[model samples]
Structures are given as C-alpha cells and as structure tokens.
Target: MKTTFEFLNQLTKNNNREWFQSNRAKYEDSYNEMILFADQLIEEMNKHDVIETSVGKKSLFRIYRDVRFSKDKAPYKTHWAGTLRRAGANRRGGYYFKISNEESFAMGGFFGPNAQDLLHFRNQIALDADPLRNVIESNDFKNDFGELLGEKLKTAPKGFDKTHPDIDLLRHKQYIIRHDFTLKQVHDPNFPEIMSEAFRKMRPFLDCMTEMITTDLNGIPLV
Candidate 1:
C-alpha cells in the first residue's frame, strides 16, 4: 500500500492532464490505494466511537483543478483531494487533506456566501464572547492550533485588537483552521500515523462545533 505522502509526491511531479493520461495506470492505482487508506481511517475512528455523520458513500479522487475564476489559473493541479459523504443529509460536508509541496494540510469545513444565515452565525459567536473563549482557550485547542495560528489570531481585522475582550471570541467566529506542516518530514513511515493522530485529536473540537451548529437552520459544521 502506497502511503498518502507517496501518492501526493507522485502527483506533484506529474500534474498535467497529458502526463496524467499517459500515466493513467499510476493514477488509478494510487486512487484505489487512497480509498483503502481512507477506509482504514474511518474504521480506526469508529473503534474510538467517534461521531461521524458520513460513511459508506462514494469518495471522489481527482487531479483536475477548476480555475475558471482565478487570475493565476493553472490548467491542472499537482495534488490530490477527496471527500466522503452520506445520503439525505442536508448538512453535508466532508474531510479533505491536500498534498502538495507548496501548500499541504488536512482541512474540513463548509463554504457559503455572505448571506443572512452566515451573518447570523457570525453574530452568534460575536455575541457570546465567553463560549467562544471556552473553545479557543481549551487545552485541546491550544495544543492543536496555538502555535500555528497564534500570529494570525493575534492580528484580526483592523477593528479588533488581540487584547480586546472579544478578540478570542472573534477568533472562533466564522473562521477556518488551516494548519500546515513540513512536507519533507511528512513522508516518513510515521507520517500517516501522525496525520491520523492529529485528526483524531481534533475530533472533539470538530464534534463540538458540529453539535453547536446543528440547531441552526442554514449551517452545518464540517468534520
């Protein structure tokens, strides 16, 4: 079984469509191998009795990068991303981890326009400063994101200062957690285990956010 790191490294070096077409066998083999890895991750989470809403569904594995709106458009991407979803779930989102030399990380979240629903979400976290602090100051969160996100969190929009009473509150409001790691070290034999460990460790925060947003009519937290 090829590790995720290997699959991603191969992808980065062979990014073009023609390259992919010529090496179709490698792509297919890697895709199937990743599916198995994802399955093992699901099973491992299940063993720990994690609360997951999506399972036993088709996961997509593709090399195409849709850059219709981007200024620096690239015909293709030298990376791989995939997701697993469940049927009949209005709150549909999935976990995705991207592998590339430039930007590589595991991220899972829902995206939406700046509608009333989203505005309400922003207001919810903005209003209740304490609960938001509870989330940010929690030991688990500190361990997972404190080092990586400290600088970003410290410098919010112009209006909000880090020392502001609501600064920590705003930190958890309508934001995304995108943590990066060193790619060279991520290819080691222990990389998959480390990645899985990080995901599992952050599961509680993901679950808590999901539970909080479940009562909302237009929001669904990603895990």
Candidate 2:
C-alpha cells in the first residue's frame, strides 16, 4: 500500500508519458498490488455481503487517463482505483476506493445515471422515501458518510411539487457517499477489514438503489 501511494504521489509530480514509460515496471508492481488488495477486500466483504464481481485485474480501473477531451491533457492519472459490483450488474453503482497523494476515500452509490434513469431514481425517492431516508439517517451511515452528497437541482425536479415533503431527496442528480482515508490507514494490514466495514455500512443505500433501478421494466413507475 505504501509503495502504491508513493508511486501515485510521484506520478502527480511527473504526469507525463516519458516518466511513466520509464517507470513502467514500478507501475506494474503497484497495479498488481492494487489487484491483490481488491481481491482481499472482496473476500472480506463476501463474509457479510454478496458480491458478483470476482477478484482480479478486471475489477481495477486503468491508470491511464482518458484525456482526449480534457483540458489538463495529462497522459496518465495520478491515482489508482478499484471497484466491486454484482457480476452482471450494469451501472447500478459499486464499491470503490481510490489512492492518491492528496486524499483517498471509499465510496459507493449510483453515480451519474442517464436522464431516463435519473427520472426513475428521483421518482423512486418521491414515491417511497422512507427506506432510503432510513439508510442515510442511520447512526452508522451518518458516521461513515456524514451526509448524502451529490448534485441536485436548484429547485425541484420535473413532476415533483416544490411543497413535496421529500422534495429535497428528489432533487439529486446522483446518489453517492464517501468516507475519506489517510495514507497511513491504507498501509495498515487491517485495511481490508476497514474497507469491508465501510462497504457494509453502505449496503442499505446500495440495496435501495439497486432495487429501485432494477425493478419496473418501464422505469420506476410514477407513483
């Protein structure tokens, strides 16, 4: 973990093709280390939660940055990240961790759903807000995530009244939660357990999103 963070820190300072190619071996090592860590996290999480994705490089994100349309135009990314989700799940959200010099966090939620999907999600909240509210309001969830964080409309979304009781919940453009971590904690041997617990705390929210998105073939039936 320390080596991984070190590599990422140095990468931030030298985010260029030349430096990265020169240090390809180090990058490979860090990549493998992340895969191993992701595998371990999968095992630990499975003890309490069912995950569809298997342990391997597939679950880890590529270090290369897609800079085609980006203004920064950095050829490589400064951090490595891994994700775990149900095996066949499309884009319903997953458990994710990112390692970087500045800050690292464990996060989960339905992120940036398409316009049609977003409407369904907001409708789910408008119709049945208690289950989602209970999860986000729980002591463990609050302690871990602090609050539901995501983009929201300035006023209310389409179809929902401004005076709706759960209008606040219906305004979200994304459903996500994050728990920050330090480099020291990432290097701890118990880091896998730490990740598992954090993901566990997020299960209720994940489950809620999963159910809302997967059910109702025509999209969350307007209720």
Choose the strongest candidate by TM-score. 2
Worst 10 residues of 2 by lDDT: 214-223
Q: Residue-wise lDDT of candidate 2 within 1-223, one digit each (tens)?
A: 8778878878888989999999988898889888888888889988977678877577888888888888989988888788887544533577788877787788888777899889877877777888788889999888889999888899998788999999888989988999988778877898988878888878778877877887674454333
Q: Tell me the number of clashing residue pairs for each predicted model.
A: 0, 1
Off by over 4 Å in 1: 1-14, 49-57, 71-73, 84-94, 109-117, 147-173, 179-193, 215-223
lDDT of 1 at 22: 82
lDDT of 1 by residue, 16-118 (tens): 6686678777766767766665666566545543425344224445556778888745556666555533233333324556665567676544333234434
TM-score, per-candidate, Cα-based: 0.64, 0.87
* Candidate 1: pairs in clash: none
